[model samples]
Target: MIIEEIYQSYLNFLKEFTAFKSISTDPAFATDIANTARWLQDQLAANGFKTEFITGYDNPLVVGSYIVDPKLKTILIYGHYDVQPPYAKASEGQARMIEEDLWKAEGWENDPFVLTEKNGRLVARGAVDNKGQIALHLTTVFELIKQKKLNYNIKFLIEGNEETGSPNLRHFIEDHADLLSCDSVLISDGEIASGHPVIEVGFRGVINTAITLTTSDRDLHSGLYGGSVPNAARELMKLIEKLYQGTTTIAIDDFYDDVIAPTKEELKNHASFPFSIEHHHRVTGTKKLFSENSLDFYTQTGLRPSIEITGFESGYNGVGFKNAVPHTASAKLNIRIVPNQDPKKTVKQFEAFVKNNTPSYATVTLQLGQGCKPIRINPKSELATKAAKLLTQEFNKKVLYKYCAATIPIVIDFKEILGVSQVLLPFGNEDCNMHGANENFEIDLIKKDIGVAWGLLS
Candidate 1:
């Protein structure tokens, strides 16, 4: 009854937060974005935090501080209020009209913004990816405040554009270093591996690229020019084949030059992970896994450089069929890099590799997006051990340590910019479906995370 009451009250605030529909990437949602930031400032200010707004950026930032002493240690909490929009096809992604139409047509039968309990999970769009997790942190702080036992200096950096690559955070941090400086930074933007408490120690870097090949000006009939002409689709596939043609290792020059292999201790720790290839298959909905024989799922995912064809398009793909070879074909590759790998250098190397592999008949071009560097910390450190112990005691389960296989660019920025160690302490379940439809957060996991936060002060 006590926890249910606490959660019930918290759910009311979460409902208010989620109702904003704050999708930052679309300018049409600009008003919603601004209102969300303003709403957050009001909520934190009401909760006894000194909240202010920082400007001169793509999106305004909300900074809330609860400083009890200058002598006590300080911790910085970072989170985003942005939620991704409904999914869209790549072609329709850039055009707002098309995306909007699709969003409206989807009918959203369930009302995504409303907070409801389904099988004990709190459901909403931004519920777990950040908003719910961050809300739980606030709830914990409020609980401590109610007992008149709150201490330490807390700075909450809640941004509105993290889903849009955090376009202004680096500059804001650089400009206000004195105000934001702290001993440790806490991030709950990730999730638990299975059902255990994880003090994530590392995450892979990323470089998303698109390579396009043009063989002719227009689509050619396969029946007439099938053998005489070089099919753009075939040429593109040939170049893609060379990227990881025969082996699991990528074929780009200097791609792995800066990659750091897992240490012996790290490997020993990885062996104990609750990873299952079968479970992976079930979650991913794939019948087979690549390089399963040569690499463990954790090793291949967390420690090595890998390439994924996130999307590919070549010839005609219609309901019936088209009997022509398309003039242009493109493949989107998202390379997941490791620690020490420079995304700029990797892109240069990838460009050269793409050029050298293209045939004479086809001309190739590359489009590269932003890159994120990897980050690593010791899970056995004093702060991590204390947090782990608190979580284990609260959950009554063995705590887990993991290297996040995905990329969190801001973690690298926290280290490189603030010169402070950062820890990813997730408060959501693995099946929260972050960035996907029907995303939700587990209330019990949030309680465990709150316990960790309480331990930090104790």
Candidate 2:
């Protein structure tokens, strides 16, 4: 009855938050984005927080402060109000449209903009990543304020454009550093692994780029030129084959030059966590895993660097073959770099590697996107240790320190700009399906996360 009542109260707020459809990447949703920001400001203002709008960026940022005492320790909370659009047009540079119909095709059971409960999970677009977390945190803070149990000054820096690479977040921090100054930061934007508590200590950097190869000016008749001339598709396939040594390591020269291996202590801690290769295969629907005999999943994904060919196109992929050779072939590359590795420098190295490996007949072009550097927090910090112990007690499991193989560009900005210690706690479940349809957060998990927040803040 208590959780149900709390859920009902939080549900009212979450419903209002999720109804805005704050998809920041699309211009059509600009009004919705602004509305969402204003709505959040109102919520904070109503809860006795001194709320204001931080601007001069693509999307306005809602900042809410509740200072218990000027001399007390401060913890700034960061979350986003934006949700990914239900679909993306091809003109957006995507290979295909992400149709909303696919939500139902993928077993989505409720309207993405409506917060609904099914099987003890709250489902909505930003349910877990991260409007749900925002609501949960606000609820905790509200209770704390009501009970006069606050010990630390609280600040909420809720942004609206995180899904779009946080283009102006660094500048926002730079412009308002004094207003945003804090002793530490609290984040619940990630998820727990295998139902266990996690303090995500680090995340890999990222380089997004595209590689295009041109073999000829136009498509040639495959029947006549199949054997006489180089097929762009075949050439590109050859280059791709050389990108990897076997199935595990990248073939690029010095690709691992700056990668820092897991420490003995980190490995020992990682080994204690539970993992199942069978479950991984079943969940991912993969035939097999890479280097399973040698590298553990966490080591490969978290500690190591990897290259993924996210999109590839060369020849005809239609109902029937065109019976011609493709003149141009392009592949999208998403490179994940580790700590100590410079994303820009790594892209340069990758460019050189691709060009050098291409055949003389083929010409190559590289188009680069923004690069985000990897970040590692001090897992042994006093705050982190204390939070980890609290989480372990709350979850009744040994808290695991996770090195996420993903990129949160703003997290890096927080370290470089704010220069404060961070507690990277994850409050959602592993199968919350973040960024996908039917996104949801477990009810019990929210209760647990609020308890953890109460413990940390109190």
Candidate 3:
């Protein structure tokens, strides 16, 4: 009956939390982001948490401490308060976003900011990626306190720059190690895999690579000098072609030097999971799945490195294409690295490759964006067992202990700064559309996760 009792209150809290445009990447929402932190500080303080703000960054870090006994093992809850820029700024190298951003994105079941009940799911921005999961923790803690059942000390390090690649996270965690230190960390920021509960062992590391080629000072008439002048877009395309010789391989030297191969046990576990190749294609909207050694879908997703072109900005793309040879062409790429690969080192290799391949007639520059190293917790660790048991029991289904291909960006920082055993307990559905338009979460899963949080922590 705890789920029933907390139902309406849960909805109300999420409703207010989702309304804020706390986009960490946009300085325009700086005030709104500050307000969001204040709101969380107040809420955590109200729940008996000793809260403080770590300011002076693009987004502030909210630290809340709640201690019950000196001898109790303290567990840190890590989550983000910031979100992806809701609306897109096309002029600033953004794809024109639909709606008021996600709110009006087509095919949405309901308003993204206003929680709408569609079947047993709640549709909203930040509904499941992070905000929904954070709400589950808060509610569980609130109930635990009310019932006098808190079993362990809790230290919450809620950040606001995760969506923008957690630019200041390493600095923040290193500075406030004493405040956020804990015996173990529990993060609810992944998707439930295999139609059941999942214990994610690792998330892939990421490095955003940008390539810009300038062939002229300004746009030149394609008709007048099309044959004589070099096309910036063509020059960049040639570089990309050299980067990816095939669909699944990066031609850059030393790209795979640091990749850690999975253990025999890990491979056997992945093979045991009920993964469907067809279903994987359907969910991802891809024509085919690719990996280095023709690994299974799950393994290919989480265990390998990937080079994805996220954005390619160049040329005349407005109404009625102006016949002009583009002078400046740029490409945005995300290189997803697996365990043991150093993100900076990998970027260096990529830089070397680009430098070596640039045509003499064209000038090229490489800009490295945000990147994080991948992290993996031993699936058989005691902490993993404890969290996995609670999650499986809550869902009444088999749990998959797996690796995620995408990077969380914060977990590595947690390990470096807090030096705690990290466990990923994913409560969000796999098809939640997190970070995409029409994001949503199953209300039942949220409630179940709250109950599981209570069972495990309390």
CA RMSD for every model? 3.3, 3.1, 2.4
Q: Please, what are the lDDT tens digits per residue for candidate 2 over residues 60-99? A: 9999999899999998999999988654344323345365
* C-alpha TM-score for every candidate: 0.88, 0.89, 0.94
- C-alpha lDDT of all candidate models, in order: 0.79, 0.84, 0.82
Mark the regions of model 1 whose C-alpha exceeds 4 Å error after superposition: 89-111, 220-228, 314-324, 380-382, 455-458
**Candidate 1 on 219-291: residue-level lDDT in tens?**
9998998888988888888889889845578988777778887788877887787877777776666887676
The positional error of residue 266 in candidate 2, measured at the CA in angstroms, is 2.1
Query: What tens-digit string does per-residue lDDT give for candidate 3 at 1-458?
Result: 87767666678888999887787778888998999999999999998989998887558888899999989998888888887754445443225544554445444556666767787888877888688888888878887888889998988888898887888778877777887778888888878875788888888998987889998899999999998988899888888888885778888998888887778887898898988877777777788767767787777878888898877878877555689999999998889999889888987898889889988888888889868998887676566788778877878888898898888888888777777788888889877888877788987777787778888888
| Poorest lDDT segment (10 consecutive residues) of candidate 2 | 88-97
Q: After superposition, how far is residue 167 of candidate 3 from its true place, in Å?
A: 2.5
Ordered list by TM-score, greatest first? 3, 2, 1
Q: Model 3's lDDT to the true fold? A: 0.82
Candidate with top TM-score is: 3
Better-scoring candidate (TM-score), 2 or 3: 3
Model 2 root mean square deviation, Cα atoms: 3.1
